[model samples]
Target: MTENEREIVRRITDVLEKMASGRKPSRIEYTETDAPDDSTLMELEAKVVELNNLYAESYRFILDLARGKLNGDPPPHNNFVTPFKQLQSELRHLTWQIEQIAAGDLDQMVYFSGDFSRAINQMIDDLREREELRQQLADSNHAKDKLFSIIAHDLRNPFNAIVGFSEMMVQMVNMASPADLKQFAEMIHTSAKQTYNLLLNLLEWSRVQTGRIDVKPMEGDLALLIRTNVNISSITAEPKQIQIYYDGGDSYPVTTDAAIFNTILRNLISNAIKYTPERGEIRISVDTNNRFYYISVHDTGMGMSEEDVQKLFRLDVIHTTNGTNQEKGTGLGLILCKEFVTMLGGDIYVESEKGKGSTFTFSIPK
Candidate 1:
């Protein structure tokens, strides 16, 4: 029934009808037959069929791309190729750009000209800002965790000792000998003093954390600060027979916060006395250049290993160690000292040998 009407126009119309219904053409042997009278119509129909095949191939590549299959070389966009291959190339480039950003290269930018390029560039910028904020939050959380650990473990110990010793004196004073009474009282005094000092430093650290401490820098005498600390330290040093030495010229001034300078000196000297054996020595000295003042506290005491020195200033590490004569410390003093020194635009450092001694030094900008 179809042999009489198998003209080129009818054949192309049948092909379009099949494609329009989302169907494939049936396989059939086409025998040579009389061509259409309109030669130009047959040529146009042949080109249309070729274009249809071309578009189908591109659709396959595009379908894979839609599913995130960005690998492998694709056919080049040629004369027969429309915007599909161009899209494939763009997607492949976009895939690489995304990989670079995930690898921490936030500077990558897309240069394609369109809404997609602009959107991608904006997304990269947003990611960069968020990455910076994420880092700051991580640092703050780490500081908080370190402070909590010290409070929960180290601060509790000294307070417990003070309460226990004081309670013992109250309950046993009548039955205790005069010597036992004096020893128990001395123990209570030592524990209370240590606890009080730790509390003061902890309060100051809290102030720093809450952004309450405004740094007010002024010119002040570094020597006088050292002298004041030396006098205060001597009261505790004398009890252990530890000799304190001070070396600095009069009126050696620097631009700094007096309170912060005083805090650094007090903590350093206090640490020295805690670690020194009976009859050991501590020396405080000062040196300076045009732009900065350097203060040092050197001690003839039980020294530290390299690892211990490294851990001393880290809040995340287990840093607490018993001082000589079983003196208790919260490790907060050095942490506070470092924070204060840094606020005044200075850096504190420690030099020590395992069996020798430790010299804590700091340089403050003048």
Candidate 2:
């Protein structure tokens, strides 16, 4: 064409070639001249300059995105950079989701299509499962520590008492008075019984932890079971003059695992006798709702505070206290009662006030 058109064509070709080669193109400029094609050439040159500027902006924006500089200035609104802007928005959202996940929100999920989405969701699920297992392991370790503490402290005390008192009795058998001999014998007996109860509870608790205990339920006389436990517990209670009163008329029928029921009753009765003062009273009573039998062991004993009661069933806390007669406890009996009650498809609760009394009630399905 003419010189002006030829110059315009050359500039446009150079700009297009630079852009095609992924290089920033220089700004296009055209001077106004008194030629017939000047206006059209100038117009074309303006379009070329605009295209070069757009290409430079797009290239910078894409470079920032590639470098993970998500907080930089966003691309201008244009058809050419629309997909990049959308990608930036998605990436910002993903960053926020990742931050939330890092802050312990495992529920965050990525929904973008492709392997990234699947990988992120899978990571969240794995983190949640790992957290659950970590919590379980911590609880298991705490339980083990509590058991070891009881065995080391509580079990050792009773055995020491038994051994010390029996040895004293043997050494003084020929020289000691009848009253002293009887006293030593009684001490040994008390310590032996305590040791036996602790050992039995430890065994049963271990069975429970191992998932080896089975519930064997049968229909039987509930009152007889209560009376039996009360009778056995009375051997200890009579010394403190703590009277146990159970008047279930000898024929309270119920369905339960008889062995578990007996163990629960034995512990409750023993606890009551242990804590109740001389001349105090223990009342065993049963009430029935439409679906369950509620058995209560109410005792006029040195009761616990609200805080101590709250600590009673938690494995992470050991809440033992001396009985009214300075009787030592491992605080394991109530824990066992709770476990056995739960195994029998029941729940146990306690109501007590400091220095007033405590009532332990458990429900069994009728």
Model 2, position 148, has a per-residue lDDT of 95
Error of 1 at 109 (Å): 5.4
Best by TM-score: 2
Best by lDDT: 2
Angstrom error at residue 366, model 2: 5.1
Quote model 1's TM-score: 0.73
lDDT of 2 by residue, 322-361 (tens): 9998999988889889999999999999999889889999
What's the TM-score of each model vs. the native? Answer: 0.73, 0.80
**Which residue segments of model 1 deviate by more than 4 Å?**
1-93, 103-148
lDDT of each: 0.80, 0.86
RMSD of each: 6.0, 4.0
Tens digit of lDDT per residue, candidate 1, span 300-326?
998899889999876666577788888
